[model samples]
Target chain A: MDGNKILVLDDVSVRYRKQDSRSTSDIVKRILGKSPRNNEFWALKNVSFSLERGDMLGVIGKNGAGKSTMMKAISGTLTPASGTIEKTGKICALLELGTGFDREMTVKENVYLRGAFMGYSKEFIDSKYDEIIDFAEMREFQNSPFRTLSSGMKSRIAFAIASMIEPDIIILDEIFAVGDGDFRKKSQQKMQSIIDNGDTTALMVSHSLQSVRAQCNKVLWLDKGRMVMFGDPNTVCDAYAEYLNTGKLPQTESLAATQENPRNRLKKNTGKRLAEAAVYLMLLLVIIAGCFVWSQYDLLKSYVLAQSLTVEQIENEAANYHRQIDRLLEVDTTRWDTGIFKEGALDIINEEATYTDVAKEVLLQAGDLSRDQYKKALAAAEIEAIKYSHMARLDALVAQMRTEFEAQPEGKYRSLMVYAYTNCDRFYDLEEDCENDMQKVIEEIRTFQRKAGQSEDLADRVWNAYKSEKTYLLSYYCVKLR
Target chain B: MTSDKANHRFLLSELIRRDFIKKYKRTTFGILWSALSPLFLLLTMDVVFGTFFGRNMPHYTIYLFCGLLLFNYFSAATRSAMRVLYDNAQIYSKVPVPKHYFLISQSVAQAIDFAVSLLVFFIFVAIDGINFHWRFLYLLFPMVCLYFINFGIGMFLSTLYIFFRDINYLWPVVTRIIMYASAIFYDPSILPGIMRRLLNCNPLYMCVDYFRQLIIHSTVPSLSTHLIMIVMAAICALLGWFTYHITRDKIALYV
Candidate 1:
């Protein structure tokens, strides 16, 4: 928990599952939680270590001893299935020499290009440009293609450029093996200086026991993916060398033994994961809810806008529509004036006027008419026809009464008037309408009053008097016949 | 999380440059194919649909181009984004930069392709004598919205691709369905009422519809339509980011 401990590996174990081994169906089943883990192997088993600031830790192991895997986990390229790897500073994993070199590019270009892969800015590489060339002793060949260089030259330049990266924690994988002997010594001195500075910490993998003992104050030795020793470099490297010579793993304190029980640790890790999942789930809910609220806001806004009018307002609007129709009717009255009923006019017979022509002439005369005016005209015409029919019936009844009076002159004049009035009422009351069965008797009366060469005063006098006493005169005619 | 955002911004330019270089490396066409392919697709779509399948399609070329460019950008961005972890495992394993830098960088590269294809599309508009009205200026709005939406989907799918890997193959079919549902060749109005309504809910379709509403229809989208697009982009971005962060730690393992 102090500032001194720059890196801590608390019983870290990395498991590598055979990713491509399972069939598609098996993978689906496994994903669906219908099956268990398949073809998974733990590469590191409860390995634990810690390094303080300015600490130099050398890792010594045979091939496949989980050394590379531990380095990868430290650099965060591999995720551990269990345990934890925590570092408190900037970590620069110095991978293989010339890891990203473009063979077609010059050595100088490779420096910039490789620097980018190492996550260094162009300006940083620019600042460190000269120093790298001097260290690698490739100043003369800096402009030459990287492919043209000798293998030694390439490795020297790559190592020189990579080592210029000044970070808090440095990860070295067989880095000391770069360059020839003198260059190796110079690079080892640089490594020692980086460690001597209180600001830097290093974890390195090396095959050389002598070099590890010479350069590193502490060493970790591994055998078949198990840590054999972790202590003073001289002691551990001596033990490691002894084991190599004797072909046996020496009995030593297990570095992972002091760690907490893994079940308790699993519980802790699971608790942390559950908390993370809870946070993510809560965030997800908030997002979904926010999305819903946004859409609903839009929906609600449009809904409210579309449904803005109330039922009472709609009823009021219907009333307003009726008022508008009346106003429109008032605006242009002639457009609705065409007569639809012409049956009353069709029954009229005249020597000069055909019924159809009479109807057409009446229609022509009903100019600039409205609906009410047309209806009134049709009713008047119908009344005139009824009056004419009644006039004819009155004449027939009067004639019959006169024939009876000849047989008996004093017979009932009341009977004659009653029959004449009852039968002739249609002609007397000349109210016009559609579909009536008589012609206009007023026209015939007017024609009789307006006979040729008659004086104007006499015509006017007879027209008025005739309307007043026509029924009286008819009853008198019946009495005279008697 | 804030530090991750800063990391991406710090290396943003470099990341984009690296992505562009990586995408077109060693190819004679370089990045020109980004524009060229959409042009070719537009031609093929115009010929096939304008002459035959969609004979009733009004301005079929531009209609198909709108969908093609936007969807193509989405496909390109997501395809590259899907491989961000697996393809650049070397750099990621060496450094501790944020994974989102990869997504943004890839999306920017796709945006360039989108811009190029769009330029070609506008030229066709001029050739066809479609009025390049002031409304066309609003196409920028939808274009910006589409890029972000595409970024969001890329982040979502690429994150899932790390876990499942099968999503890589499934994605093509998924995009094809989206394209069909988007009314890329045929007008969305030609779709059944329910289908059109459902298509309105599609974020890709929403973006396309927004563009068409502005440019093709020469009308601003409704307030709700604009809201849906903005919300869709915002929500997708939110989900994409958190999905990435939540699954980010497991990316190396799963890949």
Candidate 2:
């Protein structure tokens, strides 16, 4: 390791054990004095490279060519099975964007979160919030929840936050490949500016050889875990292109191995290989556990609030019942989200934030359209009935009730009869209390009785039946005089 | 290097803030839910277990809440920590901070929530006619101890979860088992001698039992209990810290 070099890799290699020992029986057998054969694959080998201050090296390799493994080692995320890596500087990498973003948090909140993960202070982030938002063109949407934004918008926000660091060494993995044409140009210019500042060294991995050739001072090429070439961008990329084109090595002289680049004689760690090899998922009961909790602020609040409000018979019960059936909704969904009018459970739905209202509906309905249709018709009819009085109200209410009664065989007319009785009782009670307008009330009752589809002699027939039975349930005052 | 430490602390606080906000965002009741959730659990447990233990236990709800408060902090902290690496994989793979920061941030956030919920617990204490003695202040010792244990358990679980994702599913069940074993509801005195002895082995139970000794019994636990709590905490912290250090670099690869 040279003192002036920002990073030095002396024949670093990473090895992954094969899948033989992953089986429990195999592991058990191995534990019981049975030695397992060597089964391993080297993902990277002898990948020696060095960088000085302000040096930009572009890494190019095909899939499974050890490019990502090298990046992981350089970023200090993955340890090498053999060889050694030494670096001297504050380093940061952008291997992925929006990695830790909480889907429910706002863009501004995500900025702080991403910054925290990047190890930046809040004061520094606070100072740069405007610049970050401005760069992403997300000034208006800074407060919107991250899940609400488009995937493209999310990447832009992530990029803006990741680009704010001014560390001595920066590692980037396919960050410029995000966003649209305009955004791509904007970020590319930003990357160019960061490089031009002259103090930071960078190692970039890209499939775009044209970009690497244009931007990098030197390029490193790899093919199937071997370092094919490490030299000027034109020479290395041309050689890589020729190799890909012809399926053979380009006849070019290799970079002379300097005194610093020795045949790295680091010890291989066979013990560490065991743990990483058995990393495949355990053969255990895979419970659908993510089902337990949801964004419960709404659910819990709704639970407490739902308890305090007075029950409005069917309407409140329907809301409560809807919320109750859903395991998650049982905890959340307040009246604000679920706009239920008291007369009979008519929901004035807000299309944008309907889930806060509709999630319970799903839990209760669960793609059952018959119940939904009945509910919609019932609610609409109830609202219509309550909007009018006497004749018109009874006519419409009975029509709706009959339709609802006919649709479902289970409830029959039981539910409708109860509602109708309640309505009749309410109307009669109104007629009795309105002593000042007895004539008008009586006329209204007569009109409603006709609206019920009764003939003109119905009152006479009812009087005769009452006389025959010797029953005088209705007094002269209680009866509507014709 | 001074800026580096400052940076870590600042990052820690920001993570805590994010955890807090993400949990309660768009929630109607916000932080009040944190306090109210325990009260809700206490009521359910009291009703279900009330007939069995209510008559025998003095101030049954208060006793239940004391144990619940501590166990809940552990559950919340570890649950939060459990998902820190996997959930944050998108960022964790990119950013180069030490992996333990994620777990530490979760613990701190849960600690803040636990602290807030305690305020609500005090409200109940007042309503239940529980007297405010100077000894109530002694509850701070167990509270601090509980926080450390929570952080330690969280770190350990987070590391295990990175390697074996089944641990995520296993966690809630484990916490429930701990809660039941911790004597959160029924009295341990009702158990057989062997089982009661085993309760001493569970760090979670020991912490909860000590906390109850402070808040409910209104006295310091005997020196042995104190020593047990301290030793268990140290062991958990050391184990968790060691696990984290060993597995820290490997976590990125798994993600």
Candidate 3:
């Protein structure tokens, strides 16, 4: 909390849940109020560290030793599950080399973008842009996309951008592992200059103990998410070196054991979470309500329109609508059912005579009629069915003219209208018989329409039903009065 | 929280700029695809359904374009935004930049594409012989609302995606359903009564329908349209933000 302290951490602990082990079924089970097995591990546990102005601290740890996690916690990317981290000023983090640089964008563009990621303003980046390019020695390929650059070149650019930004704290993670020896020496000099500025604090996580001993004044050693040592650079570095060699800590009092227990120190209050849960519940309810209102939006619009209209206006609209319908009804039109059978009857009438004769003999046997009587009845039935088909076609043409005045009706209505009017003129030139086969055709169509309606599969059902009926009607007598 | 005011503004512009560049990267026609792709879709859909519905509906092409523009924007923007967190895990998990900035930038980039497509839409409108009117400017209202809605949904989806990769597979199916329900290529007026009402519930349809009302019918949108849009935008944005705020801290670990 002191003025010189640029960054401070008090008992910061970060827990990471392994999400890969969770399955979709587990999610459903959890939603059903059954808790799944926990798969959480502490990435950083009760980590407390502080850095003052001009302090150069080096963090040393083995793989999976919570080095990156601690840096992330400091940079503000990953919030600690339990603990408080207080920082005095902006943090410029280079956690990964070329972290925010777009591979497709030019190196120059990446500088500005990466600088922005570090929380630097455009004008500020612009002012420092030339210095950064010169420092990274990327002037020749600055216009080229970042991906075209070598790994060392990318790291230099990343390092140059972070070093040029004059933030209160700068976090660098393994940036020195890349680039040539020349670049390393140059970057080391840059770090020295930053420390010499006496106004900025730096935290570097590195595996190079030599660099930590040479450049950093303070050192912190970590092992498995727990801080093992924090002291002068040489002392901790020696201890870390010996530990790495022997896989054993120095015979010194344990820092982790001396620190206060994390559980008792961490807040256990559930009130805030309970309130959040209630708010989430309310949000879900409101969302559902909103959906209901949205679903009724059409109704809402009509109600609004109705409200805006006077009684006389409503009456006038209603009268106008009725008048239109009356005009449509006045024109003599074919029934919706009559037009359907006409099309079916025409197909059968157009078939080859030989095929029909064979079908007629089969139908005669199936019908149990005397052969001579069957032949005569089949001829009469054929003429009557053909005549009815012609009359139905004539009725259709009249209906087309009636529906023409109405606005474009779509879906079933339009199909009905179209079916009625289609090819009606073609039947006009043909000879006609006055006798009607209305009773049989009407019965078949009603059956088809009923099948279509009940199944809610109108088009397919109608077509399938008509196909089966077409086979029986092929012989004319087969469809006779049944 | 690390980003101050100036930094936040610069970061947003940069992020938007990156998204815009990435969208057309390596493509031959590049940004023109924004206009050409939708125009191509419009032509195909017009040919397929134009004779069926076009004969009865005046300026049917314009009506279809209005729906296509809004629906495509909503679909593309939200879908891309769904993966923003996962895609940019390299940056956000390392740096402390605000996570929602990426979502905002993505939605804005898609909004830019919508704007370009809008220009193409107007060209078709003129070719179809419909006169332009001042009321068309009111389209800004729905466009802005739609941007928020897309951003909000993107935020919500991206959050879910970080925790559950299955969302990557599930979202397209949902968007497909939304595409059908939106009635983008077809006229809602022709749909059955109950169906039309349900379609109204789809926010994408509402935005598309408003565009048609203004561009094709030349009728001013009613107060209810504006109210519904604003309400939808607010609810979605707030809900998205709430979910995001709740899970943002955990996102780094998950990603």
Candidate 4:
């Protein structure tokens, strides 16, 4: 318990009660003195050691071997289930990466925060602020939020603050793993410098064998939570390294060498090669499938669009012709003897009758008509209307078709465009109407551009195609719509 | 020996200030948070429980605040002490100072926060234009009594925490249970006969009642009961000191 001794742990044992395979209710019953099956895990058993002034002790062990548990006990982060620990000086422990740092605070503020947590006054921290920053090499980032710092930078700052407090005993738990190679080396050197000051006793936990050999004067080897070896650095480290190599004590180099046989190396290489090949094959398959899916989507879209447009055009023309026939018949009953009707009554009546029959036939044939049949019907109606001086009715029908074209469902119109683009035969037959429709679309887009205060060049390709061959204009509209 | 003790006391004071400042260093509210905690608690508890318990009581917020402020100091101090050793296990492990210093510092820190909170309560009382009596000066008696009571409990629990880590989880439950048991938000006189007798046995309730009587009601607590409270507080202090002295060496081993 004397100040000269610095730190001592005698016969430390930490045991955790393993839970029963039974339910919690069963465990409660067992607590009332009923028998229940259970197991026990000893995190540390019969661990004993002493640390002297200026001593640098490195603790090394495999995962779950209780190295951390021992550090916790020494640092007073955890109480031993059984044992005694005595210390004679102020102790500071850095058990986590950036443990006391508040991410919302600036680097300067976090330095003071950590200082305060270690029980240092604000004045003390202020005096040491520059030294802390210099050690962390983050002078430029002093006002930056801790959350903005890289992990390596944060660890460096944390280490700087922890070390600047000048405690008699400094306990570090695996903090060396932070930072890049250069920063890690610098940090290691700084730690070594602290130990070299001879006023501080350092207890470090690290898995790096090289670090232990370089920095520690004494080595403590923990195995399954028990102190297996405690002695000079070279002897303990040698034994520990041997244990790692051969999974046993008294290891021989020749045995270790022979254990690393070429056959195993070859097997590992082959496994790696196979894994690489599998990854490459997976990547190649993904690319091929992606291209196939994209092309298939394009084809499907074109087919549906072409079909929808042809159907919409045929339906609109038939509807217009039917409406005209209805008007003509209404006149025959209501206004047949009027003066305007007397002038062109017979001719108009004949044309109306012809259109009525054509509309009914077109409506009937609409379901079976391919793209070609619909275009032919449109052309035949245009020629007949021209001969009978019913060109106005044909223009009305064209106007009706244009309105229907714009109002068609987005999916149906898109599929119709894809259909027109994919089939060159039907595309040519519908070229003139498609060209006119494209011109109308370009005009509509230009009007939208003017209203939206955008450039006329927005739809130049469509206007240019309309001015060129009609087939090209049709193809352009089909592609653009899709 | 006295100089060494003075140095230790100085260290304890430094730790108290550090603890208080650390809590609000990066916070924009800063020291205002210390005052805000109790003020918020007083307002909430007054609104919630005052409607039912405050019909007969005059200036209920003031009455509730007076008692609540004192009780809050006690609860905060003891709760913090219950975890003080565990929270600062690192310091205890390496430092050769008396373990009671940490507990004392924690109580002192809470006392400072309570003082700030008291100022806020006074502002409210002033705004409400409550009449003051010269006997209000005696309010210090109960305040000192509460402080000692909290200090004694803090010392006891800080030592206990080194041995039992489960004390950390048990503290909040104990605090909530004692909150209703004490005369924090309501007058204890409203309790039924047997329950009132039981409440009388509570040290915190007696201390708070004394404050209410002296400050709000403008009367001294019965001399006999005051004497009993002083004796009880002395006994707790002695017990706490004895427990700490006996267990001080073992804390570093345990924690």
How do the predictions measure up, each by TM-score?
0.69, 0.65, 0.73, 0.53
Alpha-carbon deviation at A60 in model 2, angstroms: 2.1
- Which of the two, 2 or 3, has more lDDT? 3
lDDT of 3 by residue, B29-134 (tens): 9999999999899899999989888897788888888888888888888889898988988777867888888888988899999899989988888998989888
Residue lDDT tens for model 4, B63-92: 888778777888888887778777766554
DockQ of 4: 0.01
Q: Please write out the lDDT profile of model 4 over residues A208-285, one tens digit for every residue.
A: 888889889999888767566887888889899888988985533322332211222223323554566566555545
Query: Which stretches of model 2 miss by more than 4 angstroms?
Result: A1-3, A16-26, A29-40, A96-100, A250-482
C-alpha lDDT values of all predictions: 0.67, 0.66, 0.73, 0.66
CA-based DockQ, model 3: 0.34
In candidate 3, stretches whose alpha carbon ends up further than 4 angstroms from where it belongs are A19-21, A28-36, A208-210, A238-247, A250-482, B1-3
Give fnat of each prediction, in order: 0.26, 0.47, 0.62, 0.00
lDDT of 2 by residue, B78-134 (tens): 888888777776666655667777777777778889999899888878787877888
Q: How do these models rank on TM-score, best leading?
A: 3, 1, 2, 4
lDDT of 4: 0.66
Which parts of model 4 have CA positions greater than 4 angstroms off? A1-8, A16-27, A35-40, A100-126, A140-149, A165-168, A195-200, A250-482, B1-109, B120-134, B148-192, B231-255
Each prediction's total of clashing residue pairs, residues at least 3 apart in sequence or on different chains, is: 13, 4, 0, 11
Best by DockQ: 3
Per-prediction DockQ comes to 0.17, 0.18, 0.34, 0.01
